[model samples]
Target: MVDYKTWMKELDDNTKLTQLAIPGTHNSAACHTALPSVQCQGESVTEQLKHGVRFFDIRVGKQFLKEGDDAKDLQVIHGKFPVKIPFPRLLKDVLKEFYDFIKDNKSETVLVSIKQEGTDDWNNDKDEFGNCIWDRYVDKQKDLWYLKSDLPKLGDARGKLVLFRRFGVKDDEKKQKFGFDAASWKYNTTEDDRGRFVVQDFCEIQNKDDISKKVKYVKDLAEKAQKSNDDKLFVNFTSGSNFFDHDCWPQQVADAMDKGGVEKVFAKGCGIIVLDYIEAHNWKLAKALIDKNF
Candidate 1:
């Protein structure tokens, strides 16, 4: 096995983060969520990490333990569907898995893309539990993470959680607060040369016909990244699901992308490739992305 998780150790410490072809999982912890549109991953977080996935997209929300109960805890949510792991459990169980993996593989680092979701107002400083989710989850765990906003070399970020904040920062005083903002990139909008990275969010795939179009768009962006002189990170998404069609899952889109032309783009070397149902098809797609780095 290639052991893609710690592959960065083989590269020079000065290697630009943007230049590495990282394999990521979209909705990383939602494998247990039963919802069609929400359950993007098929493997647990531990499995994903062991298989060489370094980037994780995690969505969280506050959920009441009981109806009308004042007590609430953070839960992994994808839209209306809540995954099996609660916030505390995720930290104690799911995230701990990553920490252990990194501890053993000192040269490896993990990038987490966390966003607040569900009915609760994430903008509020505190949830009903009177505990600040940001403080407890992110701020307190400073030692385990690499919160710097700027891109860093592989050696600097090794054995830490490199945060990619999808939710807005709460405190103004914490301007240079850890991690990079996902909002830094254009969302579901036209592509343009801006910031230190290039990202395309074509996640809205309503019908089977939309699959080819989205795949082509991602391919074009990857090709552009390969030829560009800007040295910007390219985050391409090969995941989507439609509420109307349960069969149109993220795995299907990923499979389509694999067959359509993603292999060729990857062969020339590419940037971060975020995928869903990474364990499906015996992890063929994820392995393909990792192989590009070799």
Candidate 2:
């Protein structure tokens, strides 16, 4: 059995990060308690780290607005649905999972992508999504995260969570410096190359057969990512879904992909291939990506 907890301990520090394949979860937090359409993964963030997943695609929003009760407490969300821990969980609590995991396993680093999910109060001008996080959460525990807009060496970021900020504030300098400038991600794009990184998030799987198209695109992009210069990060999202065919949903899409075309591609480093429901396949694909690094 592969020991995932300290998988990066063997990796070279001089490697320019993009040279390795890092596996990730699409919606890193949504559990089974959420509505089927909203639920993506079956496990918590801690379990994902223990099982070899690295990057986390996270969505945050204000929780109590629809109840006529509102606060700035950011909670995890998958689309409009709140990720449930039986009830909505605070973002700090979800983040604690990352902190705790990194504390015990200092050799490993995790990448987190934070995006403003809903049209809640936090999205308004009064609050401004990015500044709220910077003020309330980031200011308090700045040491635990790597907040630079550029990628760092594995040695420099080993014990911290690398923040890939996808939320925006009014200040251009802050926005530019706020973790790799993914604030305006191009959706369904085959390749959104932003100099330091390239993102391929084709996430609307409209039909059942379209799964093959997504699979091929993910494979092609991941292979392309491997051929790129070491400084450029390739984020190929293999997960996609829509409201139509049940197979187009996260779990079914995951199952189909589990049996699809990733086996050969992952034998070598394939950049960051973001997935969905990683727990369903017993961490097979995630572990495969990690293995390629060595």
Candidate 3:
């Protein structure tokens, strides 16, 4: 069997990072939740990596252990639904899986896009512990991450967790921050060098009719990226669900796209296609996205 993790080693060192085809999971760790609107994937983080998913969308929030407790820890969340495991546990699990995969196959890298979720005031520079989230999690684990803002060559990021910062940074003028600024790239935005990336976030699915429209919108954005001459990265989201109405689920959206001939739209290439319920259909959708690289 082909090792999808090491496939990037075949590409040239000068290849633009945006030009490569990458498979990603939207709300990657929400599989364990029972809520219909919150669950996005059926596979765990380790399983997704084993099945060729290189990019992960992770949301973290502050969680207090008890009432009036000054101490709090980060927890993974999907909208309002919180995962059973803490953020530190999730990070440890992912790192264990990632290091094991790359120890044997050293050509692959993981990109984690982290955003703040829930109602906590994450915008503050530091928490009650007098330490910023970056200092508590990212800065201490520097050896395991690729802490650079600019896109680098494949050779530079091998066996590393490339940070994609989707949250605000501290305002300290003396300290230098790392990771790609995902907030600068707005939702459903056009591609440009200044933005560094483009994203399609049509997440509202009200009815069965909305599924077809969402799929088409995703395909159109992907096609636009393929035709563009610029090198800005494109992140296409094929996941959508209604929270209040529950009219649609992420798995249903993914199935609709697969059945509606979505694979044919990526003949040229797909930058980074993020899907929900990636383990469904025997991982057929994920394989189709990875096949575009060849």
For 161-192, candidate 3 gives per-residue lDDT tens digits of 78777765554431234677675554543333
Q: Considering summed lDDT, which 10 consecutive residues are worst modelled in model 2? A: 63-72
Report residue 249 deviation for candidate 3 (angstroms): 1.4
TM-scores of the candidates are 0.88, 0.93, 0.87
Q: Model 1 over residues 1-294: C-alpha lDDT tens digits?
A: 576666767777887777767788887888874655667888889889888898888876666454442223466777766766443224335667777788888888889887766666443553322234455666666787887888788878888888887666555545476577664556564364557777777877878998888888878887887777666777877877787885577767877877787767774347778887788777876788777766
| Residue 203 of model 2, lDDT score | 81
* Model 2, C-alpha of 13: deviation from truth (Å): 1.7
The reply for model 2, stretches above 4 Å from the true place, is 66-70, 120-127
Superior by lDDT: candidate 1 or candidate 2: 2
Candidate 2 backbone collisions, by pair? none
* Predicted structure with the largest TM-score when compared to the true one: 2
* Cα distance off (Å), candidate 1, residue 103: 1.5
* Tens-digit per-residue lDDT, 1-294, candidate 2: 457878888877876577788889998888648766688888888889898888999888877554332556788888777877567877888788998899999988899988888655444464367777888778787888887878888998899888987766677677655666666658888778877778888888889888888888888888887776557878888888886667688887888777886757874557888888887757888888888877
